[model samples]
Target chain A: MGTRQRIVVAGGSLAGHSAVTELVGLVPEAEIVWVTGEPHKTYSKPALSKEFMQARNELAELTLPDVAGDRPRGLRILRGRSCVSLDASGRAVTLDDGERIDFDQLLVATGAAARMPGMLRGVDGVFPLRTLDDAVAIRARLADRPKVAVVGGGLIGCELAASVRAFGLDVTIVERLDTLLDRPFGGALGSYFLDLHRANGVELVMGAMVERVALEEGRVAGVHLADGTEIAAGLVLVGAGSEPCTQWLDGSGLQVGDGVLCDAHLATSSPGIFAAGDVARWTNPIYGLRMRVEHWTNASAQGRAAARNMVALATGRQDLRKAFADVPYFWSDQYGQKIQMVGWHEGHDRVELDRSGDVPGPLARFYRNGRLIAAAGVNAPRVVMRLRRQIEDEARAAEAA
Target chain B: MKIIVDRQRCDGNGVCMGIAPEVFDVDDDLYLHVAETIPEDPELRARVRQSITSCPILALKLVEE
Candidate 1:
C-alpha cells in the first residue's frame, strides 16, 4: 500500500502510554515510537505517594501492567531519551542525544515536573516525590524515622505526610494556604481533611510561607517560616506543585500558555500535531473553558481521545473524529480514607453538603447557576459514583437540548 | 464468569466499588470484598468485567469457567 504513517509520542507516563495503546488499536499499520525521559517502563505515578512510602519493596509492586504486549508490529520504544525540540512544519523532533526522528503525526504528552521552591534547591535531606527514583530515595531516607517536614498541604504533600506518619515518624505540614485542599474542595471540605490530618497526629502550619530551608553542614536541619518561627526537622519533602513540561517546545510556534493550547478535539495549533495529559491546555466544551487537568483518569481518557482524533485527521477520516469530553475524576487515599472528586467546581457559586445525620461520611455538591457542576466526598464512594453518573447524564441532556 | 481479587495487590482504592457496586464492596476499614463469586446475570458479568478493567491496581481478574 502507501508509505506507513510514523507516529511519535513524547513522554512515557500514563498519558503517553495510553495514547500509544489507543493508536495501536485504531491503526495497526502505522509505525509508533514512544520517547520517554525515564529509563523504566510506565509505572503507577500515583502509587509513589500512596503505597511506595509504606513499603519500600520491589518496584514491580507499583509497575503498570504490560499494555505493550498488544502493541502494533511496528512499535519502537526509546527509553531514557527525551524530546528536546519540535519542528512542527517538518514533523520531526530532536532528542537530547542529538538524534532527529521524523513523524507523520506527533502527540506531546510530556506531562509535568515537580515544583521545588527556590530555597530548597541543592539542599541535602530534601526531596521532591515525582519519579520512581524519588520514591525510592525518600523510602530509603525514612529508615531512620527522622523528623519530616512536608512543605505543602496539597494532595501530594498531605498524602506523603500521612504515609510518613504511618511509619511513626514525626511529620509536620507547612502550608501557605489558610486551609488544605481548598483549591479543589473549597473551605468546607478542606476542613474535613484538616481534621483528618490532625486526628492522625500530623501537625499543620497554616497560612505561613517557608522563608528558607535551614541547612546544617550542607544538609537540611529544618525550615524557617516567614513569621520568624523555626520548625526543626531532619528531612524535608517539597510538594509545592508542578508545572507542565513545555520547555522543549519554546521555539516551536504552537500556542503555549501555561501548557500547549489545544481545541476541543485536543488538536494543537499546528496541524497534525496534538497534545494531551498535563502538558495540554485544551478547551473543555462541558466546562466551557480551557483547562489542563493532571488527574490520572483525565490523562488516560484524554490520551485515548487525542489518539482517535489524530488517527482520523491523519487517515483523512475527519468525520470520525470525536471531541474529548470526559469528566475529570481523581481519588486520593490518606489515613485509611478515600477522598474522591469528579468534575470541576472552580467557579461554582454555591456548595451543599448532604450528610447523613451524625454520620462520618458526607457528599458535597457544587452548583453553578443552579446546575450541579462537581461533587466530592470523603469515604463516600457509592454516593460519589451516583453523583458522577448524574452529572454526566445532565451534560448529555444539556447537549441534546 | 468468576471474579478473583488478589488481596495482596488490592490497595483498597474503592474504584471497583464505584464502577460495580453490586459485585464489589469497600468497607469502612478500606477492605475490598467481593459480594458475589460468580456473576449469574449477564449485566452483572459485564459490570464485573468493567470493574476489572477500571481497577488502577489490577487487583481484580476475571477467570472463565
Candidate 2:
C-alpha cells in the first residue's frame, strides 16, 4: 500500500512515547517506526523524581500505553537506536548505526536530558536525578545510612533530598542561590521552603558553590565549597537544570534559539517536520512569553498537539494551527507540603496578593499589570483553579482586543 | 444533548466550569462535574462544547441526539 505513509518518532521518553501513542490514534493506518536511545520499554518521567526514588522496578510499570503493543497495528518499535541526523533534503532520518528510513512526516519529540555538573564519569559519588538509571545509582547510596549531599536548590534537588531524608539518610542541600526553586518562585517562597526543609531535619547550606567533589578510593567522600569548606557525604546528587537535546540538530538548517524554534502550532521551519515536548520552544499566548519547559504537562500537551498537526500536514488538512495557551503549572512535594504554581509570575511589576497570612490555603503570591497573573498554593487547589480561569479570561480579552 | 468528561485527562485546571458554570462545576479532584438535572438552555450545551474544543487534552465530549 505504498509504504503506508511512514511516520517516524525519535526519543522514547514521556513526550516521545506519548507523541507516538497519540500519533497512532490520530492515524491508525499510518506505518509507525518509533526509535528510542534507550533499550528498555518506556515509563513515566514524573515518577523518576518522586516514586522511582523509592524503588526502581515500579519505574517501568508507569508506562501509559505500551508503545510496543499490537493495538497500534502497524507500529514498529526500535530500541537502542538513536537518530543521529535529520536529513530533511532526503526525507529520511539517519540512525547512529548508519541506517536511514524515509518518512512522509517526522515528529521530533527528542526530550531534554539533565545536566551533570563537570564530568560525572570519574567523579566519585556524583549523581544526577533524571532518568531511571540515575535513580538506581542514587538508591544504591541509601544503604548503610549514607551521608547525602545534594547540590542545586532546584525542584528536583529539593524533592530528592526530602525523599532521601525520609529514608533516614543524613541529607543536606547545598544551593548556589540563597533559596530553593528561586527562579520559579523568587526568593520569598524559596526562603519559606528553606525553613521547611531545615525543620524537616535536612541541613540547608544556602549561598554556596561546590568547587569540586572529593574522592577517596574511587568513591565520593565529600564536597569542597568555593569558600574553602568541605562537607562530608557518601552520596552527592546534582539537581541542576537540564539542557535541551538539540545538539544533533546543529547545522541541520533548522533555526535553534532556546529550542527548536516553532510557531504557535509547534511546526518547525522545514515542511513535514515538527518539534514538541522539552525540545520545542513554545510561545505562551497568555502573557506573550516563550519558554522550553520539561514538565510532564507541557510534554504531554505539546506531544499530542504536535501529533495532530503532523497528521494534518500529512493529510493536507490546514486547520492544525491552534496553539497551546494553557497556563504553566508546576508541583513539588517537599517537607510534607505540596507546592503548586499556576501561571508565570516571575519579574512581575507588581505583587497583587501575598496571602502568607493564610497559613495553608490560598497561601499565594499574585502578580500582573495591576492584575492577578499567577498564584501558588499549599493544599489550595481551588485557588489555583480560580487563578487559572482568571489568566484565561485575561488571555481571551487580550486576543479579542 | 449532555456533556461528558473523561476524568483521567483532567488535571484540575477547571477551565470547563470557568467558561460555562451553568453546565459544569468542579468535583473533589477539580474535574468537571456535569449537571444531571437537564438545563433548558441549549446555549449552555454549545458553550460547554466550545470549552471542550479548547481543552488541550480532549477530555470533554458531547453526547448529542
Candidate 3:
C-alpha cells in the first residue's frame, strides 16, 4: 500500500467536475480519474434548461475551469464511459465497456435522470429534458414552430414553455396541481406566475391529468386529458420530476432510499466511498431532516466538501472536517422577470404579501412559521438577497442564543 | 488573470459590470459576460480580479496567468 492514492470520480457533471477541481487542490499528489457519460466536456446543468434553448451552440460556451491543461498530468478525463456497477467489497468499478478500475477513494456524483412516467410510454415526441441531448432535441422541435405541450408546470417546465413562446412557437402547459409551482411557491405567488405566463401568450391548463399520450407516425401528436378532451401538440415535454441515478449500485450493499443514503459527512455506508450532488441523500442537522437537493449551489458546495473529506481519509489528515448545512436558495427567470427564492418555506402557517414595492414587480411574499421560514419574490432580487443573508444569520443566532 | 462565473451561483444581477466597466457587461438575457480576457495587460487584470472577489453571490473566480 502506497501513500499516493487513486481517486475515481464517476459521472462528470457539476458535482463531479467540482470534485475534480477541489481534489486537485486538496490532494495534488493523488491520481484522479474523471469519467463522464457525456461525450463533450463538462458544462453547467442549469443552462441546459433555458439559455441553451434560446441560443445555438451555447453548450460550447459553458466549459468550466478547463482542468485538462497541457499533458493533463494529475487528472485523466474519459468521455463517453459509463460505469455499470460498483463492487464495494473490492473497491472496484465495472464500466459498461468491460473495463475494470480500482480506486483507493471513490466519489459517486452521477446525479439524477429526468424521470419519465410509465403511463406516457409508447408515446412519441414526449420527452423529458436532462442531458445536452435532451436539450438539443427539444430545440430542434421548437425551431419547426410546433405547437408544444408541457406537463408539470414547475420551475423548469414553466421556463421552457415561456421560452418556446418567445421563439414564436405555440405553447400550452398542463399542470396536475391546482396551481403552478405547487411545492416551491404558494397559491398567491403561483397565481402571479401563472398570470405572467398567460399574459405572454402561454396557455395554462391547471388541475388537468394527462391520461395518455397520442402518437402519429411514431411521434407525439397530442396528449389526452383525463377529462376525455385531446389537446393537440406537435410535441410533448413532460418535466414531471427526476429520480436519483442509483441503478448502477443495485446490489452494491449501500443503503438506498429515495437516493444513496449518506451520513452528515456525505459518506456512504461503505468505507472509502462517498456521494455528493443530486444523488446523495444528505442529512441536515440544522433542520433535523434528510433530503436531496438538485440545485447547482448544493451540488457545488457538497462536491467541494466531499473532496476535502476524501483527501482527509487518503492522507490520514485529521484536521480537515466535513458536515455542511446550507439555507436552500434557488432562482428562475421567466417572462423577462428574474424570480429569486430563499429558504425552505414548506408547510407555512401563514403567507404575508408585501405589495409595497412596484406593482407586479419587486413584490415579496413571506412564508412564516410564527417567525420567517422562507420567502419567494417576483422581480424582487433586492428582497431575495437581503432575506438570504438574514435567514442564514438568524439560523446561526438561534443556534447560539 | 481571468474571471470565472459559477453559472450555478450567478443570479444574472449584472452588478459585475458596474465594478469593472472595461471587462464585464450584461448580455440581453441579463446574464453577466466578460468582454475580454486580460491575458497580457496586468493593470486591467488586477481590476477584473478584484471585481471577481467582490461579487456578491461569490459567482466569480479569478485565474492568474
Model 3 ranges off by over 4 Å: A1-3, A68-71, A186-188, A358-371, B1-65
The numbered model that scores best in lDDT is 1
Q: What are the RMSDs of all candidates, in order?
A: 3.0, 5.1, 5.1
Ranking of all predicted structures according to DockQ, beginning with the best and ending with the worst? 1, 2, 3
DockQ of each: 0.33, 0.11, 0.11
Task: Give model 1's TM-score for chain A to 2 decimal places.
Answer: 0.96
Candidate 2 structure quality by residue, lDDT tens digits, A153-228: 8888888988887787888899998778887665547657877888889888889988888888989999999999
Better structure of 1 and 3 per DockQ: 1
What docking grade does candidate 2 earn? incorrect
Instruction: Mark the 10 consecutive residues where model 1 chain A has the least summed lDDT.
Output: A63-72
Question: Tens-digit lDDT track for model 3 on A69-187?
Answer: 43356788778898889999989888989999888889999999988889776566777888878888888777778899999998779878877877878888999987897776655
Please give, for residues B36-63, the per-residue lDDT of candidate 2 as tens digits: 7646676575456545543433467667
lDDT of 2 at A231: 92
The docking quality of candidate 2, as DockQ, is 0.11
Using Cα atoms with residue i matched to residue i, what is each candidate's TM-score against the true structure? 0.92, 0.85, 0.86
iRMS values for every prediction: 2.5, 6.3, 7.1
